[model samples]
Target: MLKIQEIREIIKLVDNSSVDEFSYEYEGSKIELKKNKGTAAPAPQMVQAAEEVKQPAQQAVQQAPAQTEAAPVQAEESKPAETTADDANLHKITSPMVGTFYKSSSPDADAYVKAGSKVDESTVVCIVEAMKLFNEIEAEVKGEIVEILVKDGQLVEYGQPLFLVKPE
Candidate 1:
């Protein structure tokens, strides 16, 4: 059975993705998610089957994605806005998925980029680990990094700003 936090993370991923439906089964437990047309996020259903022949299986419809939305809201509130007049020409490098931010490929390695670091469209600026996959994030714009928006190991939401770059 999946833990509550893990389930929430899965729900967030499904919500942020374009998939219309998703299903997973493990042991006797199953999870299903289907997106509602015109809705921004999908609703998930969790099912647990009892091993004992005499006991009835239990099914639950979980609508906790609304609660999960609050976490990202709080995170955004705590993050200082980068849209000041001086930063108007700066470009933002945003996370494409929800994950843990890693400044380096490994803890002992030097950070991929930092403040004042120059980068091109293909430069791997950092990594975002999602569901055990470390996605190398590219700068996508030629510029000098002006700031590192999120700290190492921080939980980042989909489309959250990860870096600020001053375009060349």
Candidate 2:
């Protein structure tokens, strides 16, 4: 359980710093502070209530777009060689979180999908590994892969475009 003074201090630290999120653990209690002015804070009561109040703030920070400005520029510069003349025809499958983009199931395996491969909603196009968990990323829209937007082994952030596809 976190004391009100501790929560206030955490909030103050968050406001004073440029950090988007701050987490601390002490005496078996955890404190997580997030920057999200959009979320309304609940009137502080029990520790459980404070945690509930903080949920939206944490979610917003986790899902926010402002954190990805740097990655998109890099991804844009590294657009695959095969992506030409069809800029308007492409649809993108983007990363949902910060993770390592993997082209194949493993180093020796073939890529799950490649340029010119057709994919449907259920197709597992690739994997994005975060915190040692391999996440199978799907093609949400049916399309032929026109270009892959990230290099294998590259670090990708939330909402970063991963593939450019020509929708069927």
Predicted model with the maximum TM-score: 2
- The residue-level lDDT of candidate 1 at 39 comes to 66
| Per-model TM-score versus the true fold | 0.55, 0.59
Per-residue CA lDDT of model 2 for 89-138, tens digit only, reads 78878775567899999999999999999999778988877666577788
Runs of candidate 1 exceeding 4 Å displacement: 1-83
| Clashes by residue pair, model 2 | none
In terms of TM-score, how similar is model 1 to the real structure?
A: 0.55
- Model 1, global lDDT: 0.70
Count: clashes, candidate 1: 0
How displaced is residue 24 in candidate 1, in Å?
Answer: 22
lDDT of 1 by residue, 104-137 (tens): 9999999999899999988999998766657778
